[model samples]
Structures are given as C-alpha cells and as structure tokens.
Target: MDLDHEPATRAHEARLWRDDGWTAKVIKNGDDDGWAVEMTQEGEDEPALVGPWTMGRDKKNPKPLDSAAFITLVKTASEVLRRHEQQRHALLHKNVTIDSGSDRLRIDLDIIPDEYEPYAELSAHNGFGEELARVRVQPGFKLSRESAADWVANNFARPS
Candidate 1:
C-alpha cells in the first residue's frame, strides 16, 4: 500500500464521491490526454484500481461521477482488494502434518517479508493441540518430514 509513492498524488483536488469504504478521485492521466480515476479504500495506503475515465458531454472534460457509476466502481475496487488480501494470506501461511516417531505433529509456517527484516516461524503442535516448539527460521526455510524430525529430535533447537 502507501499511495504515498507519489507525493503529489497524496493531496489532489477534492474527491468526486465516496461510498462503501471507497473514495473516487479523478486526475489528469499522465500517459494520455484523457483522465483517469483512482479508487482507494479506508486504511489502505494504495488505490485498489485505476483506469480510464469517461468523458463528459463536452467531450473534453472527464464525466462527472454519478451515484450508479460510483457504486459499481466501489464494488469492483473492493473485489480487487479482497482478492489481493486472500492471495497474500495464502502465500504467507502454510500447514502440514508429519509422523514423528509415534505421535503425529502438525507443522505450521508463517512468513513475514518485512523490508528491513524478513523471517519465517516454524511451529510444531501435538495431536492434542499442545505446542511442542516454535523456532524463527529464514524466510526460505523448508518445511518437510526430515526437517520436522530433526527439530523434534534436537530438543527444538533450530537445525544447523
């Protein structure tokens, strides 16, 4: 997020309209002579989508925002953000189960790709849902039967 990527875009002319967690702002398109609209949601730093804007009757200025059109834009933009979040959630979290001697152990991996610090956590849970171990590993840490077995055998210390 952080539409702040463009400082000038941070503060533009007043928004034409806003509804359903979306704000629509029309701006002159830099690539072409036509205008473009940006739809941003509350708490999100970036706009969900941006595309060409329709022209008004004058055929020179962009068309004014209307209730029906704005509502449609809100739904489309919301869907875009929702799908993005879901995809990231799937990529950041992973789970698996492996047989550790007799009792089965559930393994979970969560990755945090921070700008300054990227890391992943590997955790083990017993059949009864008791946490056996949690260790911080590199972002590229591999989760597999062999790795889980090593962790369980090494008293939870991170594999060398």
Candidate 2:
C-alpha cells in the first residue's frame, strides 16, 4: 500500500507540512536555484497548486512551513480544484429554452464523456418541469438556439 493513500497524521516540518487533508511540500525549482511549493489534497494523485516559494532570510533557502502558511496553501489549492470542477461541469452540461408551439420548452444536452464510446442525452422539459422528450445523440451534437428550434420543429425526433 502506498503511504500517500494512508490516513495522514499531522506533520509540520521545515520543507513539508500536512494537516486538514492537505499537504504542502517545498522543492527546488527546476528552472533556477529558487524553491517551489506544491499543495496536494489527500488521496489525490496530483498537486492542485504549484508555485514559487518564498526565500528565507538567507535568500538561499526556502521559508519554513508554518501553520498560517499551510492554512493559506490549503485554501488556494481547494479553490483551484473548485474552479476546475466548475469549468468541467459547464463543458459537459448545456441547456436552452425555446418556444414550441404554444408552450415553452427547456432543452438540455448532457454529454457523457465515455472513454471509448462517448455519447450525449438530448432532452426537453416543459415550463412545469415535465419531461417532454428524450433521445440519445452524438456527443459532439451542437445545442444552440437554431438547433433546438429545429429539434422542436421536428417533434423531438433524434437529430441526424
């Protein structure tokens, strides 16, 4: 079993710190003699944030990890993860409302990004949130005003 996956106990060291499900590690910068710090959430495979670290009073060593610094790093890394999740959600889900006959319909296209066979679900709902129609379409299906209008015009048939 990998130690990284094990339940963590609190640790506070000069170059490494772990607490509150987050770890901050300081490393030598690849491009220069300066140092860089990486912030990773527990059980995650990759660091959510990596940036330049502050130099110590000697200017040749990295600043020691402290309680305040670790707390700030966890906040920043959590925000980065949150933004990434939001962006991905926006990419996979789409919606538009359009006029259909006498009733307004909300059209949604939710993409399922499968590893080998990606697909999408095209669905429609009425103003009262009743399901009108649902069909599977190609993952690359475009869900725009004109495309939605065309679908509604076709009685919710699967788009070619």
Name the candidate that leads on TM-score.
Answer: 2
Off by over 4 Å in 1: 1-15, 43-45, 153-155
Report the C-alpha lDDT of model 1 over 55-121, residue by residue, as the tens digit: 7788889988877778788888889979999999988988788887789999888999999999999
Please report, in order, the local distance difference test score of every candidate based on alpha carbons. 0.82, 0.94
Write down the worst ten-residue block by lDDT for model 1: 6-15
lDDT of 2 at 133: 94
Q: Backbone clash tally for model 2?
A: 0
Per-candidate RMSD, Å: 5.3, 2.3
lDDT of 1 at 69: 77
Candidate 2 residues 77-115, lDDT tens each? 999999999999999999999987789999999999999
